[model samples]
Target: MTHTSTAQTTTDEFIRLGLDVLDTELTAIDGLRRYIDADFAHACELLLACTGRVIVIGMGKSGHIGGKIAATLASTGTPAFFVHPGEASHGDLGMITAADVVIAISNSGETNEVLSIAPLIKRRGVRLIGMTGNPQSTLADLADVHVCIAVEKEACPLGLAPTSSTTATLVMGDALAVALLHARGFTADDFALSHPGGSLGRRLLLHIHDVMHKGERIPLVDESATISQALLEMSRKGLGMTGITDAGGKLLGVFTDGDLRRILDQRLDVHQTPIAQVMTRQPITISADVLAAQGLKLMEDRKINGLFAVDADGYPQGALNMHDLLKAGVL
Candidate 1:
């Protein structure tokens, strides 16, 4: 009983500590609003007008944060990359060109590695934007534009770990990247171009034509075909559905496995009944140019599992189903 009571007390203390850390970090982030002033705008303008890439540099925990910031910027339509301050001093400094803009990050604003390369970076006639906690420190003074990310206190109990300050820096980086993205009128299509391997890219870039069955693969039957013939076509094509078309090759209707089940009790003569008599007329059809994602939504909205891609004149061009979308990674 005593051990259980002690364990409960320890758990409660841990929860309290976790909550306190969250509150501290929240307060630190909230305090950053005042710092997003004209200086911040100026830094963004400089970056926006830059003809070359944006170079991000930092030390220690700030380096990790800087790397993420650079990635976010690059992915969000801004061309940016991270270079370690220590590496910049050795040889990576060659990566920065005169037309490029440099963003230097340091919590103390006095990191020796970062400060060591500041003069050399300036000598290249490159614009320098500094992000630091100390607005009055040497890095801030040396920078052409200084964005202060001062936090009231660290979330760490000992006040030594970089907790609130790093969070503020990351948020600031996002703000810059998003602001630039909006200013440049970056579209989802543009984002997909950079992230073609991601799911969003597949949804945006893959079209019905890209994933649909074409040529002889499309499950199709003449309107005059009997229900049994339509079933044969559906089976041969393996799409669980068949497009019923007229003699002129214009799509008239569609017959699916669901239709087969529904008419099972009707006792209709499969060999004698025409497919057009039992098929779904004016069924939901997608254009060959439509996005695969849009096709997925149409199927979901109409409670369907398959679709036929039709041309402008209602000619069946191709066919696809949920499984095709899954195979294409669009699902």
Candidate 2:
């Protein structure tokens, strides 16, 4: 009993510590609101007006956060990259040009590696923006614009680990990236261009024409085709559905496996019953130019498993099913 109680107490203590850390980090982030003044705006303006890339440099934990910040900025329409402070001193400093803007990150504002290269960076006539905990430190003084990320205390119990400060820095980076993203009128289409291999890219860049069955692959039958003939087309095309069209190739209605199941109990004569008699009238159709992702949403909203891509004149142009969307990675 005593051992069990001890285990329970330890679990409770761990939960409390985790909550305390979250609270501390949240407080630290809230404290940054006061520091988002004119200096932050100037930094954004400088970055926006730059003709060259944005260079991010830092040391230790700040380096990891700086790398993420740089990636966020680059992916959100701003051209940016990360350069280690230690590497900048050796040879990577050549990557920076006079047309570029450099963002230097250091919690103490006195990191030797970062401070060592500050003067050289300034000599290139490049604009320098410093992010540090100290507003009056040497790095802040050397910087043309200083953004203070001071926190009341570290979330680490020992007060040594970079916990709250790093979180604040990352949040500040996101704020800058998002502000620039909106200012430049960056659209989802632009974001998809950079993330073509991702799920968002598939959803935004892929259209119905890219994944739908076309020409001979479309499961379709004449409006006068018997229900048995429509079923044969459905089976042959393997899309679990068939569209009923008129002699002029205009879509009239649709019949699916679900409809087949429903009519089975009604004892409908498959050999003589006209497809248009049992087919769903004016079925939901999508345009070939519509995004495949929107097609998926339409199917889900209407609780369907298949759809036909039709022309503006209501002629069947292509067909697709949920499986096609899954294969296209839009699912």
Q: What residue runs in model 1 are displaced by over 4 Å at the alpha carbon?
A: 1-9
List TM-score per model, in order.
0.94, 0.96
Model 1 per-residue lDDT at 144: 98
lDDT of 1 at 294: 96
Give one digit per residue, the lDDT tens place, for model 2 in 95-148. Answer: 999999999999999999999999999999999999999999999999999999
lDDT at 304, model 2:
99
Superposition TM-score, candidate 1 onto the true structure? 0.94
What alpha-carbon RMSD in Å does predicted model 1 have with respect to the real structure? 3.2
Give the Cα error of residue 302 in candidate 2, in Å: 0.9
Model 1, 156: alpha-carbon shift in Å?
0.6
Q: Which candidate gets the maximum lDDT versus the true structure?
A: 2
Q: What is the alpha-carbon lDDT of model 2 when measured against the actual structure?
A: 0.96
